[model samples]
Target: MNHQTTTIDLIRHGEPEGGPKFRGSQDDPLSVLGWQQMRSAIQDEDQWDVIVTSPLLRCIEFATEVAKQRNVPLHVEDRLREVNFGAWEGKTTAEVIAAEGNKLSRFWEDPVANTPPGGETIIDFNQRVVEGWQHWRDQLAGQRALVVCHGGVIRMILADVMGIPLQKSFGAVSVPFACRSRIRVDQSDFGTLTSLHSHG
Candidate 1:
């Protein structure tokens, strides 16, 4: 059996405009520095068959431009959005601490069991992202593509690709703003990491 290889680059969106906060599902544009970081990470010679990105402004804003410039197809993937923080949207850790007290800490320590009120559970989020990844892997088989998405979404996908336990998925990988992780998918639908946790 001949195994086909497909390369996918997962890029975390640049810093958001709003100051530090849970910003999940809280659509915000990228900061000026965010744009610069993205531009710096990619180059004109970079080749991609398609550009897949989250619908959020931070991810789409730059993705739109890149796709246009490269004349490649751009796909807005909803599942690529960040983990929904529910009621905690747009609230800083300090603020959440002041109001919810230790709940915030508990969530951080064990997010799978301690999901935020009305927020997405780690299991649900992981399932959704994994489905999305598998769908794309099949659709873009043997093609090189760029996936621009959120920190949480990227981490979840990385965990899925790396076979990390769902319970320890979050924070298992630290994806800084504009960071890039490369994944190679084989004929068996398994992914191998070529490069990871790079701030490019």
Candidate 2:
């Protein structure tokens, strides 16, 4: 898994003050334990070729620390940003449920077709994320890279690559804040296992 062609360690930034609650885009900095989580996630591993981040402040702060600790350049990719929660940006899940009632319950089933009040659709998210991956694939051919992104993006990547039904995306693993997901993609040979290969 170390020949080259990148073993992208996609990491979701730590939880900010309004995390696991509202706070979707816009701007929100990491909390105290969030910073600790970021430090712990990459402290033991310092061999990444490059550190890329989402434009969000939460991700940027953590990515900056990792870049400094590992002595690598920090690059920002807007497409790596989280799904815009729109009207729900600052509301709790329960609030959404109470507001939309039964309709809200179906969000997980057809988010691609449904719009979240004033937020981006699932289809839009998929498009942008894939675009981001392609951009990096071109630049990081035969190299290693580290990508900092959001929990939803990571879950989408896992769901799309693993062939999970789009409706079941919410069933993806519990992504701990600032944790690492090391995926090694091989261009020379294409296979599902190629994405699972990891060295660090």
Candidate 3:
């Protein structure tokens, strides 16, 4: 179906406590507030045609509950998973900072050629997620959708959609646990996007 318009509710999963050093790939459950955050977003909304979730349990914990309420089919997509931090998964942010120092900060500040040590590059990540989203956009056509995913992925989507440069995309946007960002995906000859924000 040619989807002329699609509403894609992009949501970031709940937060977690400081676990020594946190990095990508390590698994952690959402905090209590995280559940509360998800509750606020899902309970307030009554209808959703489909609910897609990240493969990680962090997002699944709250997403499962949302699906149960709306009786929406839950599909797990791996592409939405956070960037793989490889060996740095369990280390605390401080630990990684201390070990990598300026380089780590530089990666956060400017991930152009810099990348997480033993982790996926930002360019590859952007392409992976955008391609994944495009595939789904084609499938959804004229429909509303809800997807639960990670923070980094959400920022990447917003950055790409809003034309925000990835190097400076790590700004600490205060997103409450399980908070929802409702965006309408407009389809046109230019492709799917929101005119309100273009990728910077």
Candidate 4:
């Protein structure tokens, strides 16, 4: 069997209209600056064969614009959406910390073990993101693809590619707004993290 190399560029959505909150599953649109930030992040690149994005507004809006501009196919993938934060969905970190105290700290320390009150568990989130990633990898083999998604989604994908334990992945990866990460997978299905760039 001939294996082909696949290149995937993952980018976190820019700032949403809602400023600095948990934001998971909130469906907030991007702010004006968020639009500018995303535009600048891809201004120099136009080599994608396809664009895949989370269904959330923050990711899809920009993905739609870019796909139309470049004439590439765009796919809105629900599996790539940010992990549902449940009770913490719209609350700030400070708010969560104040309300949950040590619980928040424990969660940060070991998310796989300490899930948020109503949030998706780290294991489940990783599984879904990886499933989506594998589906694209197989479907778009040998092509360069762009994925516009959330910080959490990017982190989980990176962790999977790098063999980082899920328990350590949450804090181990820092995906700032408009951050771009590239992964190249060889015919053997081995993935390499080629580069990471952050607009901020």
The Cα local distance difference test for each model comes to 0.84, 0.75, 0.71, 0.86
- Report the C-alpha lDDT of model 2 over 32-139, residue by residue, as the tens digit: 878877777874745877888899988998888778877888899988888888887877878888887765556666666566788888877877887886688568
Better of 1 and 3 by lDDT: 1
Q: What is the lDDT of residue 32 in candidate 1?
A: 91
Candidate 4 per-residue lDDT, tens place, 91-117, comes to: 989999898889877876788999888
TM-scores for every predicted model: 0.90, 0.86, 0.83, 0.91
lDDT of 1 by residue, 100-198 (tens): 999987876678988998998988888888889878977898898999998888878877777777767775677788888888766644544333434
Q: Order the candidate numbers by TM-score, best to worst.
A: 4, 1, 2, 3
List the candidate 4 regions with Cα displacement exceeding 4 Å: 1-3, 188-200
- What local lDDT score does residue 98 receive in model 1, on the 0 to 100 scale? 92
RMSD of each: 2.6, 3.0, 3.5, 2.8
What TM-score, to 2 decimals, does candidate 4 have?
A: 0.91
Best by TM-score: 4
- lDDT (Cα) of model 1: 0.84
